[model samples]
Target: MTRTIRLRFFASVREAVGIAQEELALPDEVRTVGQVRSLLVARGGVWADALAEGRALRMAYNQQMTGADTPVGEGGEVAFFPPVTGG
Candidate 1:
């Protein structure tokens, strides 16, 4: 069954999407954080440009920072944010 996942974007990603979050229904094959990012990129235009592989992106799964291989399950909140900056 397709699962609905929430995607939250911050910093540049947020600016690009003109929003902070999106709800998506994904298939079982999309089991990792990288897959989710890839799926969003396939939406084209802003999604593609913002999530480009060359860009630096930080991710979180269910509010906990995570790596690309992190598993994502139904009802999880996956967030994408730009590299942190503090000085």
Candidate 2:
């Protein structure tokens, strides 16, 4: 069976998309966090721009900050958020 990954969106992204999270089937070719974002982009326009490569994005895997190449095991949780600015 294919592995599934959970993606959580936060802050503006969540509000814009109107969803906090989603479960996605991991494609064999999408091996990195960046790739995963690109995959979501292909879903359509909103997804594409929201997950655009050049945008300011922060990522976590299993609740920890992770790089694009971080390996995601089965049923892992990946989160995306805009850069936090606070005092």
> What is the per-residue lDDT of model 1 for residues 1-87, given as tens digits with 9 covering 90 to 100?
889999898988899989998898997889999999998899899999999888899989999999999999999999999988899
Q: Estimate each model's TM-score.
A: 0.94, 0.91
- True-structure RMSD for candidate 2: 1.1
Question: Model 2, 75: alpha-carbon shift in Å?
Answer: 0.7
Candidate 2 local lDDT, 9-70, one digit each (tens): 99988886779999999978877787787788798777877878888989899999988888
Which window of 10 residues has the lowest lDDT sum in candidate 2?
29-38
Q: What local lDDT score does residue 16 receive in model 1, on the 0 to 100 scale?
A: 94
Q: All models: lDDT?
A: 0.92, 0.86
